[model samples]
Target: MDTAKVVATFSVGIAATLTATALQVGKPSGWDELATGLLFAAFLAAIVVVVFDRLTDANHGNLIQLAFVHGWTQERLLKELQAATIAAVDANSWVLTAVRISTVAQVGISTLSGIVAVVSLLT
Candidate 1:
């Protein structure tokens, strides 16, 4: 239900998937090693997100309580409470963005790696 929890959960899940894939995807050739490296990068980036989420959640408790007491109504408070502060929210947004970019990068790298492997085989 909480954003931080969601982020942590997803990050952990991604990390687990990446680690498993990397372990299972044995390198048949050099290009495959490169792809494995990209997967590892994704796993590391996801781990960074999980750490950031924990830090953000730890610091935002007071802000959330404040928003609860000061916000005008339940619905409005719920919306506002989504962000503890503009700066923190922005930082978290950046973290999420980084995670997504890392994920995309991993996929792109994997695709290219596959292409290289195919090309190598053909040659």
Candidate 2:
């Protein structure tokens, strides 16, 4: 689905970015800062993933997301989503806005973690 696309694209982009950075900066003389940055990035990613995974859950997540669907029938689910898709389309502005917001928030949190790791390494 679109969400997965966004996630994958962002991940690849970030990985590319980090690779370029590592090449330019080379490994630090000591593990102190690099370790710190890794820890920070991991922690931030973990927190964001937990939050979003909860949102993605079928039960006890967003009520509006559940209400928009007519049923879980294959035909209905397929109608909202193309084959091999994991997300449904919503015409509602609010639903779209929420998804976009969630995407940005997840990215922000993951970036924060990477930043922390870098700063720790630098120090």
Candidate 3:
């Protein structure tokens, strides 16, 4: 999770830098404009990852709190904890999947944008 956060953060920064570089091409036509658009899309994807990550963390925290709500025998508490754990995992699976997909897209798009920006410079 920490690694994902770091990578997403780095991706966001790279997208911003590349977008700025693309814009520096003055009129920014052809590949330069496409690079800028793709960079913006990558930036939005990274932001989505960040938002999903925060929501996942919050969900986990909520599950933890709900699992330990006092009152109940040790056996009952264990059972409840197990059930909550399973339910939380099931519910959060999609969110985790989204974060993974968004992170991959963000990095991939940023790399492509960087390449396009370079190509624009050469052309």
TM-score of each: 0.38, 0.35, 0.74
Q: Which structure among the candidates has the greatest TM-score?
A: 3
Q: For candidate 2, lDDT tens digit of each residue in 10-112?
A: 7535633553354356555443345445445544553444444323322323333553564466565544445223343223344556556655655665465
- Report how far off residue 59 is in candidate 1 (Å): 5.0
Quote model 2's TM-score.
0.35
* Model 3 steric clash pairs: none
Which segments of candidate 2 are over 4 A away from where they belong? 1-5, 12-91
Pairs that collide in candidate 2 are: 33-120, 33-121, 37-117, 41-113
True-structure lDDT of candidate 2: 0.47
- Reference-based lDDT, residue 83, model 1: 50
lDDT string for model 3 (10-33, tens) is 876776676677668667778877
What is the TM-score ranking, best to worst?
3, 1, 2
Q: Tell me the deviation in Å of residue 98 in model 3.
A: 1.0
- Residue 2 Cα positional deviation in candidate 3, in Å, after optimal superposition: 3.5
Per-residue alpha-carbon lDDT of model 1 for 1-123, expressed as tens digits? 145345544544554454445445554555445545554554565455445432244245665677668765766665565654655667667667665665555444444444444443443
Q: RMSD of each candidate?
A: 7.9, 10.4, 3.9
Candidate 3 local lDDT, residue 15: 65
Candidate 1 minimal-lDDT segment of 10 residues: 49-58
